[model samples]
Target: MRAGTLIATDSGNTLAAVRRCEGSLERMRGLLWRPALVPGQGLLIAPCNSVHTIGMRYAIDVVFLDRDGRVLKVCPALKPLRMAMARGARQVIELAAGEASRLGLLPKRVVRWQETLTA
Candidate 1:
């Protein structure tokens, strides 16, 4: 699926908007020069297990997910110049600070894109 907002159907946790980073170059430059992440805005990097905030300008919340979109872990308020990892994560989501808690994005929670009905 093309990149979009991923909402938790069961818990109503909304992950704002999302930008995809799949290729090596895209993944490597994930959120590097962004000034800030608005609430509900995030970066989704696929096939990633670890991430570093070496050049990030602000802190963010991180959600690690498996291939099936089940959350593997959640790291809140991860500051810049830091790093984190999830052993079995196939995707990593980076969100604005506190967005994770507000959305109740917890481990095992399944996240998916909302389907919009056609006219």
Candidate 2:
């Protein structure tokens, strides 16, 4: 999948170096086998309202977003073997633990993505 930077436009915060997970295969793999997610890194899964961390090796923070890129909810430090769902979320961003707070990705915040030109 192509990568880019996700920013919280409201606070001018750079949320993460994100990879878009749009297709079934990409969404399914959603950080499952990664030993750890580095700071400033995350996965943006579109058209997704629910996520499971059943096999994840580490905790993560989840931000549920609407179609307009507004945050509907923020689930922080979600431990392994758990699931999170937002009723009206159209997409979700999964970040390393505490990355949400650090970036001020709270509910109602707006998120924007800028594509990175890969060499």
Candidate 3:
């Protein structure tokens, strides 16, 4: 599989694509998963209730959101092999380590994903 962007409301929040594993709740149990995306990369709507782990890659910022897409937690530069947990997270967005700070994604911030038309 190829890597893809994790886009959000803000502009130029794209991150590098590494790898993504979706629809593997059973297989991802207890294992650290990181939503890998390069800086300034954009990602579409992603499901919550999933744990993302960043392995072998550099640090990244993590944003946990509720069903309404409200920012719950923003973990900046989360080290590799480190895990960020969000119990009520309806969706978790992974951004470049410092991109969160650059984009000013703070708590209670509202985020919306811009849909892309695919041919």
Highest-scoring model, lDDT: 2
Candidate 1, lDDT over the whole model: 0.83
| Alpha-carbon TM-score of each model against the true structure | 0.86, 0.93, 0.64
In the range 5-113, model 1's lDDT, one tens digit per residue, is 7877676766577777758988888888867888877888888999999987789999999988899999999998999999989999899999889888899889975
| Residues 1-117, model 3: lDDT tens digits | 224544444555633332333554522432234345556753322465444554535666777788876788887777867767777877766666787777767888766654433
Give per-residue lDDT, candidate 1, residue 42: 81
Q: How far in Å is the alpha carbon of 114 misplaced in model 2?
A: 1.7
Model 2, 32-92: lDDT tens digits are 9876887889889988999999998899999999999999999999999999999989889
Cα lDDT, model 2, residue 58:
91
Q: Which of the two, 1 or 2, has more lDDT?
A: 2
Ranking by TM-score: 2, 1, 3
In candidate 3, stretches whose alpha carbon ends up further than 4 angstroms from where it belongs are 1-36, 42-45, 49-54
For model 2, the stretches where C-alpha displacement exceeds 4 angstroms are: 11-13
| Every model: Cα RMSD to truth | 2.7, 1.3, 5.1
TM-score of model 2 vs. true structure: 0.93
